[model samples]
Target: MRTDHMLSMIDDFNGAGFEQVDLMAPIQFDVSVRYLKEDPWERVRQISRRLPNSKVRALIRSRNLAAFDFLPHDVIDAWVDRLVANGVKVIGAFDGLNDIDNISRALVRAKEHGVETFGAVSFCESPVHTDELFVAKAQELIEKADVDAIMLKDAGGLLTPDRIRTLVPALKSVMGDRVLEVHTHSLTGLAPLVCLEAVELGADAIHLSVAPLSSGNGQPSTQSVVRDLRALGYVVNVDDERVDAISNRIREIAEEEGKPLGEPVEYNGLHYMHQTPGGMLSNFKSQLETAGLSDRYDELLHEVARVRKELAYPIMITPFAQFVGTQAVMNVMAGERYKVVPNEIKKYVLGYYGTLLAEIEPELREKIIANGASDIRLEPSEPAPMLPSLQERYPDEDLDTWLLRAQFAGSQVDEMKKTVAEGGNADEIPQPYFGLIKALYEKSEDGQQHLKFGDLAISLDKSK
Candidate 1:
């Protein structure tokens, strides 16, 4: 979630008389690199301080430990410790490939910090991704990793009703009364249906967002889901009145700020092809437009599929998504595939980020190697620790601040500190509606702004 959305969701939850709400916080690496230039945890700390009753959880990329590169045990430990200290009560840890080694270490650290862990099976579609595979993965998370629960994390919204019906039951059978949660997005327009099917098959919880912030590429609507569940004779604990109020407020704010409201998108086959998350797609569009190649957006989308396959079908999430999308953009713009392979991709092909579930084609692997990709000479045993250097740089700062500086650029940390020192909460600031009206007025040649509401028309003159 974005910082502003996190703040607003907390406020909405409190106002709605809810005693607790589970928040799926974004990964720190994603926030620092993709979302914000500064320390993203500043807002997290604020929210945690304000909402004592709410449970804040973070999504962890098990192998990378919230980074593009594989991090050492000490770095992982420090990251988990800081997150727990700041606000995160639970960590939903998962590997892009269902590699137990990738997740077990992080889960152990999370437990050491007294943070609950939800081991996840990253849902995808391929010959390797099957109901049996997920069931076995869930069992491993329970028996080996000792996670408190298991989450079927469908990052790509690839779960269909038929698949959910079979998969949910299989997972439950292996879980043997362990808690099961379903988390999926609406990219393929099947999340709501899949969510219902999961619940019917005995999922303990479902991740949802309030309307206006729900649907589209986001989660299914909490209120709508509640309604459906109740209609099916299931008892839901949420307050309908509060849900309505929160939705209304969100709608108002979206309108005032000219932000797009969450609406159902028609099922686009292209989404299935590339499996790019909604936010990543938006980022790709923005980057392409800035480069004056927005006209090739459709072409770029097609390239993503080819690139992903060539790279051996990386689960379209996080660092991998960025890596594949970036390489695709480069390929499209350069008009030649694999002409400029990123360092991350090179490292990936060399098994730095853990073994790929499927093999990269022999020809493609050789091509990547021929094009300057080489195996990094790091320890074959484990990732190198980053904390020692981090400690050296920020000798005086506490762990939380040190971690922020370590993850983000120093200037971003300074800017964040300045913002906090100035007693400014960017999320709390309302949209400048009057400034928008003034801009509209300025744009009108006659010094009169014309407005239309359905068939009704009105005019506002500067003189008046």
Candidate 2:
């Protein structure tokens, strides 16, 4: 989003009576830096600066501070400190593996900075992801990190009302005095009902988004949820006029921009079969199209299910989902299973990410090990201290600059710096082509590639 548009949306959110506004992981990931091309910290600072009256919340992916791999302790501490310094009042941390240890340090760091912290219980469906397992995980988060709240994060939107009925009470039992917040996506078209059921079962809050941004893969619409809650005799104390005004403004923006508005999705049982996220599912379709294997889309989804099962049913959330989806695409495209494995998949199977919820099949594990990069170790090693080396390499750079450089390739950082220096519309406008460059760059084994989009074409030479 452009700076003006984002600020407008934040102002609307504040005026529309949302108690807390979540700036969705802008600091802990690369999208902001890749797209916005300035100091992501400054971007977060600016967003937090807008929400003076509202509690500013941000989510972290634990040890994967800015990169897809585990960052050193120095970086993690600095990451939390920077967020707090930038005016984020609430920090919620979740690990894709649901590994409490991965998030524990970050949560503790957030609390040390005098901010409220929420430990996320990442929700997913499987025989292993039982109600008792979630309760136990929540118990571990409370016992270890002592987070102020527990966020029931159904990132996959796999939760049904029946599941919530049982799961919410179990989590609340372990919650004790801590707040329980239900945060689920509307991918399954059941999140609205699930939110209502969660509140009935003692969830303290439910995360919601206003219309135009809500009801598709995002959270349930605030307008509809509030109306339903009020009808159910709940005292929903929000400024309805302000809420409607914000939604109307957003709708107008969508129409003016020719952007698709969030529409209610029908119940799709195929979602339960593969459990791929809406965003990732769309990516799968595009990837297939690019590969000239669009007809094998269903085959690719089935391969995802098979690969997930073989790998022990990882919560079908990010990092893991990307790993599974990529491997599935490979398996389907190559017409050979386990013939090609990504380094991340190899690391995941080796327990580098975290302890596995269940064991990968012995034969499949062997196949992964055999085909994976030979350089990757059988054992996951602790990340050595990085700040010392980074500081030594670039003594003049500030901590913020060092952090960005540490997470990204030096060339990528250079490009970002150049964009900032040139007064590019890194934040003023969305550059859809930039993502294509990033994708193509990653796929280029050599240092050079040429891409053409209609009449515009560019040749990239990383060797230079």
Candidate 3:
């Protein structure tokens, strides 16, 4: 989670009416990196304890975590000790992994610490969203990884409903109650509808934001899904009045931070797909204000993938790509440092400088080409890909033994820790990146003071 990350504003739900809701025990949440390690006793830290202390959970990440290797074993052990100490159960996170063996090893550690663990990785091989491979991966996680549950995530919002209808059931057939949660996005305007479809088809839970905070570019809408799920006869326990109060409080916080709510929303089915969990404070769209390549970003991302295939070492689309989507494409293919305006970068990728043969991921671009897809769409739905040690260099390494650091979803740790650190990597943050993350933390009094790390300025890479 980002330093500015905080729990869902559901503090208002801390009353008796919660019994009226029939949701499952495990739910999804957002947390600050701080509460996870530095101050387990912080007010935000208690959100889990209040979630009926039952079945609510969340995705854990840091704005810069994608660049990190697996957590040091000591760090992982310390977090497990804390969660168990707090009565927290079923922990999960991604980022920081050299390979699948280490991921499985982390899960085993969580189990030993008396908490369930789950892991997510993009089907980086293909952009076509489906559960075909995820179902198999999730099953392997349960029996092979010893994970109590598996949660699929579409971090970039690149899934389709047709895929969900076909895949959710397949996953249920394998993981059963063990495949407990589903994380998806609104990139295609199918978040809420697709979520209901997934639930009826067999998904046990979904990740959502209660408000339109960062609606368009993040995960599904929590409130809209709760409302629709109730209509569909699935039990979702949310207090409408309490939800209203929570939204109001969130609004006050947004006002304090000088964040924009993105053009006024006109609620509709596609509403959830537009959720911006990071946008709780601001939107990524505004970040691209000057990039002038906003019109070309979608195309540039695919081009970048093409370049990665030629390099052939399961590489990733860096966070830099999220901001300068077009430039990042050129960055990867140049094979060395180079610069270009966003659109120039976009045009060049399409018109020059790439090994088109290798750039097109046979696994990814092939599928897109097969579907006759010209441009790509992103969704947040990810089912585990059930591949085991496809290229394990050392099978003898104990799958259950390795180091891991526990960074809970939405938790902030650096500032909260004993050290007072500063650097440029901390500055020039990507907008949709930590720029939005910081704004949301400035909302409430507690959050405002909480993120007050003196001189910890985030220099945005010029607005998009």
TM-score of every prediction relative to native: 0.84, 0.89, 0.57
As for lDDT, the candidate ahead, 1 or 3, is: 1
**Stretches of candidate 2 exceeding 4 Å from the true structure:** 26-29, 255-258, 426-464
* Candidate 1 lowest-lDDT run of ten: 425-434
Clashes of each: 0, 0, 53
Tens digits of per-residue lDDT for model 3 on 1-464?
Answer: 22233344445655413422211111121122223232333332455565662443433432122222223444444444544555555666543111344356556666787666676644332332235556655655676567766666665444557767776777778765565566665654656676788788877667766564535655665567777888888766666787677667566555544555422223343222221133321323443345554564444444545443332322132332232333334454443423333422332223222112124334543333333223322321222221133115325422221111123322133343332223223423422444465566545454332333356543322222
Weakest 10 consecutive residues, lDDT, candidate 2?
Answer: 425-434
Query: Sort by TM-score, best first: what order?
Result: 2, 1, 3
User: Distance from true position, residue 436, model 3, in Å?
Assistant: 25
Instruction: List where candidate 3 sits over 4 angstroms from the true fold.
Output: 1-10, 16-44, 48-67, 95-99, 119-130, 262-299, 308-464
Residues forming the 10-long window of minimal summed lDDT in candidate 3: 21-30
The Cα error of candidate 3 at residue 99, in Å, is: 5.0
- Using TM-score as the measure, name the better of candidate 2 and candidate 3: 2
* C-alpha RMSD of each candidate structure in angstroms: 6.1, 8.6, 12.7
